[model samples]
Target: MVSSMEFLRVANWVMNQVLVKSCYGVARKIKSHSFDWGDLSYKPLQQPSSFPDIVKCDLEGRGSQTLACDFHKVLLRTRSFFPYFMLVAFEGGSIFRAFLLLCSCPILWILNYEMKLRLMIFISFCGLKVKEMENTSRAVLPKFYLENLNLEAYEVVASVGSRVFFTTMPRVMVEGFLKEYLNADAVIATELHTSGCYFTGFLSKSGLLVKHSALMDYFGDTKPDLGIGNTSLQDQLFISLCKEAYVVMNEGKVMPRNKYPKSLVFHDGRLAFLPTPSATLCMFMWLPIGLVMAIYRIFLGVFLCCKFTMALGAWCGLKLNFKDNNQKKSESDKGVLYVCTHRTLLDPIFLSSGLGRPLTAVTYSLSKVSEFIAPIRTIRLTRDRKEDGETMKRLLGEGDLVVFPEGTTCREPYLLRFSSLFAELADEIVPVAVNVHPSMFYGTTASGLKVLDPFFFFMNPSPKYDIEILEKVPRELTCAGGRSSHEVANHIQKQLGYALGFECTNLTRRDKYMMLAGNEGVVQENKGRRF
Candidate 1:
């Protein structure tokens, strides 16, 4: 009888061969099948015969109608079955030869079965994809690609992607340059059509929205010659692909010390063409300013720890106003729930100083370091809906609660959806308009680490905050014969937007984080992916 090890190897070979053969069959069927081009809104899809004219974007209607052909339309449609094209074309056309193809596809419908990948961790980091496409009635192929490079010389392939390779702009530039200069046929990229999808596994077929990386791994067994990258850890994967890589620095001129002897770095002062200041030098400039801010924080902490920090904003050049200047502190102090528009961390801190009393602030973005320094009475929100409600109820019973109805801070002139939890907190809901203008270094950001937020804010030269306390809304008026919490929250958000001239967006804290960090929703399993 054959040994178990040999038997398993045989099975693996059979499975791989079968997968490749089946893929060819699918490709053949798809190629012969007539696809419905009418579904797509792009004008190119509607009329392929006009491709030359459409691609040229002719303004004078000079394009010949006879130039239109179905072949260009077919090529566009063929993108949906591009993997099959690549597999057959790359290996000199055959089911047996194409079996050499190696790629990991997200298993379809099966529960933890088939297609395992080493790059799984790398993919999560690129969840948020930045799509850059302009609407035009034309084929957006690389102009150089059409003009140069004979396709028959090498294994010509295209890489279609959304946030995959640390290479979007540079990859396109390199591909174009190579095609022009070397007449090289190797094509690797993330420039994919809207309706293209690459099949990941036997079960996984290409889908329009599927990412290019998920369809297959870009690199084969061969190590890449060289890749260009920025300073992010994710980009490090690309740099390691080559024996020598170009390091592009956005911050300072100092090249980070790397053991790679052949690596070419641009950030160091040696590149006199660009001003890449040393990181050490930047820190030296900040040390003195940071020390001064530390001293001021300690003084502010004393008042906040005691309960209320008085005239806090006035000292920092703050201007406080209200509907009625004659309003008594005692009235506001008596369980008044401050429903404020979201601005920055400085908003609550500065507002408290102006109030002549301390406020138990409910926030989602307080860092531990800032908390230690300021000691403003705060309940850090977990952002869990039910749990937060309980925390707010408990905090509400303590004293006047200051809450930004819009859950997250906005550095720009936009207001996000407010939580209705404030409607239930108290009857005396005072909508306070909190506005902050920083000369430099904003206290709040959509994407910066919370721990460093205070440093950025305090480091600014004279950050000014304005607190405008509006008329209080009673519970009876809010309900108007009993309204839902959502309705009340919506009303407050609309009012704030109208009064402050701030645009309203449905974008939540998650959306902001996605935009800033490309963190696509899934809770990160680890801090960084190690090769």
Candidate 2:
């Protein structure tokens, strides 16, 4: 009989051999199946034309032409698909699932493309809710996709009359973005098997959509006018059916914000950076230390004075830049109202810390957890114009008050339309500009639990906030000086926008929630508290 240790070693070796052989077997099976390209036979070009050839072809002149392209190769800057799978796992499933997917990176690297894709799909989609996956694909994935878009590729696609994209990814993951954002006429991709409303973590019976076969079926014997793809044999074979074919080289270039086909005003996700495998590993490694540091920082802010907290926070990787442009105020019993542009839930807390004085904050909604952990006084505002106006007036009469007139946090460099009520509340209104930078995680989410916003913000390795208190609005611009409330609000919005180098838009909280969360931005009242 073998010894226990010897038996264990033998078992491990056997398992390793089985996994390697199984993966190779799958790879062989995939290669053995050859796709029939129908009767539309065209000799493969010995050397396919590059992207510039198509650019030189002047695509705009071909008004009747249609384009067929590979989604990842032609559109994205990066070829690796790991980051997208990690996003599905983290946002659609759970963090543990994401970590498990990260741990399998070594195995993924060794396996062939087909096997690797199968493994990643299983890990990311298994046991995930269909609704949750749809939500992430709708809200979280578009931002990353837009960020990775290739400028040269987009120029060609946008010039064409009709566009069809093919991909190996599940249709549920990429369909929404491609159709809604890129205006693709159709997206042919793999379909996932579903058990009721949950993903079964396996492909449908039809299996992965073969790009060549799908393209043939889509356009029938009539060949496409233009085809764009990468250097892979599969892509090369698929595009050969077209009258004109162009191969995009994997040169690292991204589309600039100014050149974006559409503006990205609102996106919903907790991650600020792309979660590639190595980046995911680094984030997990820092999490233990990050949590401890976050608790310490919170304790300091709650117990100590703002001046002391600021001094100590700098030593622990927290940066606060404060600038005051307020003119000396006459000694009066009435308090001044500060209208600020919202960046994160912590904007009020940081402003109070910067001023080294306590101030009342008015918000549309606050979670019970956030209200309990807050360092300064907070008051909730009901949407009723009469009631909210009275609340702000009372708060201003008591002491200095801070109000975020945009009513919600916006991550992009655009300020939402300001509410005119604040302009009517006080004669002396000061506009404040607030901006935050977090290296790893975002502090706001349109769909996730609101209670975790501040915690996630503090979890960053280095978080920075810039607070600029601008000079008070001239008396002539005030509502009390014969100006309409709307005029005063618009004036303040423009002032903050100019100071922060941001654009002002008429987008409201309702528009943001509808786009991201698929709901109106209303909090249900629970036990006499609104969250």
Candidate 3:
């Protein structure tokens, strides 16, 4: 019985005599003792671009040096040594060659069969990996499968994190990825396939593997240089990913020089503003105070009359501390519309209650669904259907209107798309910004409730109210000809954002007022026309 060591010795001797001579004979030139495979790091092999470096280092190993004359020649020379050595061992009438041949044949057959099974299994797993890689890479992949012989095995160092490696690839695929996407590092993975089942790899700057999972986790990290320069397939993949992140990051870097806060609420409301405190005090103080007294008297009468619902409404108004502008202008000259930045269901109520007026409010269809039975007079705009421009024209052309251009409210202090019905009444926009202090009670309205601190109701409602009327933009600034309603709408929104003290990052003219103001509109201290 031949021991494993003896077999390796015989194999090695034959490999030297036949394979070495047929190939380069460099193995014989160098002393075998000088080669140290154990200490040789595999770093160079990991990079396909470094193949030339491998060839250059071939002189360090006698056996490797002999094997350097192209890979196939060594395989052929080794095959020739096999039969001759077997024949010499068994003599002239030897069946050793035949036995060796038969044994080799079965092993080959079994190996080939097993390899097919493994290949199928591996490919199934690989297909999933490929899909994941494509999703993660956001890059296209090859449409074809690799031949079994062309596939190479490789162990990737990407076990860390969610990263996994698909190291090996057909040379053509490697070449294609590099050429098409300008990836150069792919050549290393392709060269590994010569050994069968090689792993496709990407080297990160930290000398770590940027495999499929890694790419997914860090999609645009491994910046493989795909720019106008010489690079490999792997490099290209890395660079492309890095470039993607670069674009996204750089997008945020550009300063918005032309950005301005929008005036959507004011434009929609048609309420005039005078920033000067004296103007605002003159306009709002007297009328609002007088109205409150009159309302109190009316409330006493209604209570005496046993009109409970009207009393309830009055009570809610008082509780909300509603106050309207005190300035008394003639009805005809009250041409300005109250363009309140819409926030919540409370906004219309807030403005009406605060203003001490029977406001002609506009609401969307969704809001109208629940609000149809409400006593307030309002026009419901269909959210799903196109607006009837003429209907809007009639309303604004004939009467004072209160419009909330901002359609929704959010936590972020920014405006949304503004409504354009007020655009038709462009001659009468009075921008109004209302900010309400965040409520202490969990219950905001009878319809919606959010309880914060359980004991907040006990806290004083003093300093609870904050309503502000900002300086209004004139009709000349608002009304323009030959421009689409959208442009006018956008311009209005921008102005409102500026007036209301918000960054109009994504606001449009038709967005509701509540979105920018949250639940509360900022209260300008002076009642009427603030400059």
Candidate 4:
């Protein structure tokens, strides 16, 4: 008698050969039976051209012919017993290979039985449902209860109070049911669920009800049950076993993918979510211009310092020392809407680089325009859109928004009348003062003598610069009727002058004209001798 190990080895070899032969036969039959454009004489079947006519083929009385064909297929698939015999004979025989073959019998039998059982159950249930629907005399119930049917790895979709239970339905069907029957606007699901279902909702006539989902932490929830279908029971069992094996394999492993996203409470008294990909890309694209500006500033800065150093080499140069008198030791965690005195063209860049992290600077839409060829890093406002309370509500909710209340640059370190844009963000204000010593050769005037004001190169390069950041101050003014933005602007101007060691002056005539024009004035102020 052959041993169980020997029997198993033979059975495995037979099964592999049979399966390969069957597949090849199916493929060849499909190919040979296919219709071509040239085969106009022969009538084509009503069914799809690629389908195999296996059931239609006559398997009658020529038993020898059928047997010969089977043997030929097996020979083609396995290349005959000679190769197998030669391999076993030439090599040392291993008992383990034979043991593994013997061990596979119970697994294969279980798989075969499960597949047959699932198919039988599916056919039986569907038939029963069809027959019940056909019956005319039977009282129709509002809801149908389908029980004893283990639909594992399969899905069903229907309305909550629906009579029909759509079997093995997908996102397309679910979306249609929700829009047509349920008459609802939004259907909630997970990220995966939305991606899968949103297209279905969009393509439908009812228009896409936005696909939405929320991610919740799974605590002790029951494992999700996917109803079974074409997915093999053995495959499912294997997956479960593999999952447990992975847990055991990774017994003590701990891996952290990345750090948390950074956040900042801005200087202009707004909370800012740190740079997103859109913002980061905007910042990155601005690097080229930023680099050019930085290099120009450095060269201009060194030249100015050298000139100052030489001039002061003989006389003790004004004893230049900086003291942040506004700095408070007890005032930690104070939020400020930094009302800055805009003077030199480099004021924004100077403040951004000088201030510590978590200080958000308010910039204009024009600042965003400079980033257009790159990415827009700053908060953008249209004077038109600034009045949008809804947009402002959303913007303020995000973080502190900085506003250059003056809205234009000035020659002296003085503030212009403030815009009410600041009043929308917060009540807290931190007055920042930025001063550029001995100003620049701003540009040529109409008569061609170089004017010393900073506005000429508004978007151009600044020769050199110095910026001063002060402590947080409170917002004393409210946006009440009759209270103007100018009143608040003057308040910040005086505070800035005292901090930056400069004389605070009212708006120059050119400043007034530019503000009226609603354009950033790029004009040069007349050069005057400095004491």
Which segments of model 3 are wrong by more than 4 Å? 1-335, 367-373, 383-386, 440-465, 480-487, 507-531
Q: What does candidate 4's lDDT look like per residue over 150-184, in tens digits? A: 11100111111211111111222233333333232
How many clashes show up per model?
8, 0, 111, 17
TM-score of 4: 0.30
lDDT of model 4 at position 137: 8
Deviation (Å) of 119 in candidate 2: 0.9
The most accurate candidate by TM-score is: 2
Best by lDDT: 2
Provide the TM-score for each candidate, comma-separated.
0.45, 0.88, 0.33, 0.30
Ranking by TM-score: 2, 1, 3, 4
lDDT of 1 by residue, 233-263 (tens): 4334444554333333222222222311111
lDDT of 3 by residue, 1-531 (tens): 999646644654553344323322342223134422221101111223312211122122222110101111110111111222121111211223223332342233334322322332233222122322222121112111111001111000011111111222323233443333222222332121111232233222333223333443533444322111012334334324422111110001111223211122222111122112222222222233323333433333223322332333333222344334425443344345777765444455446545555556666522323254334467766553345554555666666667776654432346677766567654556666655443212112111211211112212111133345544544445555555666667776777677567666465432322332222332222321101
Order the candidate numbers by lDDT, best to worst: 2, 1, 3, 4
**Measured by TM-score, how close is model 3 to the native structure?**
0.33
Candidate 1, residue 498: CA error in Å? 2.2
In candidate 1, the residue pairs with backbone N, CA or C atoms under 3 Å apart (3 or more residues apart, or in different chains) clash, namely 49-68, 49-69, 159-189, 252-276, 253-267, 253-268, 253-276, 253-277
Give the alpha-carbon lDDT of every model: 0.42, 0.81, 0.34, 0.31
Name the TM-score of candidate 2: 0.88
Off by over 4 Å in 4: 1-335, 358-360, 365-369, 372-376, 385-396, 438-440, 443-464, 475-487, 501-531
RMSD values, in order shown: 24.3, 11.6, 32.0, 33.3
- The candidate 1 region of ten consecutive residues with least summed lDDT is 266-275
Candidate 4 minimal-lDDT segment of 10 residues:
262-271
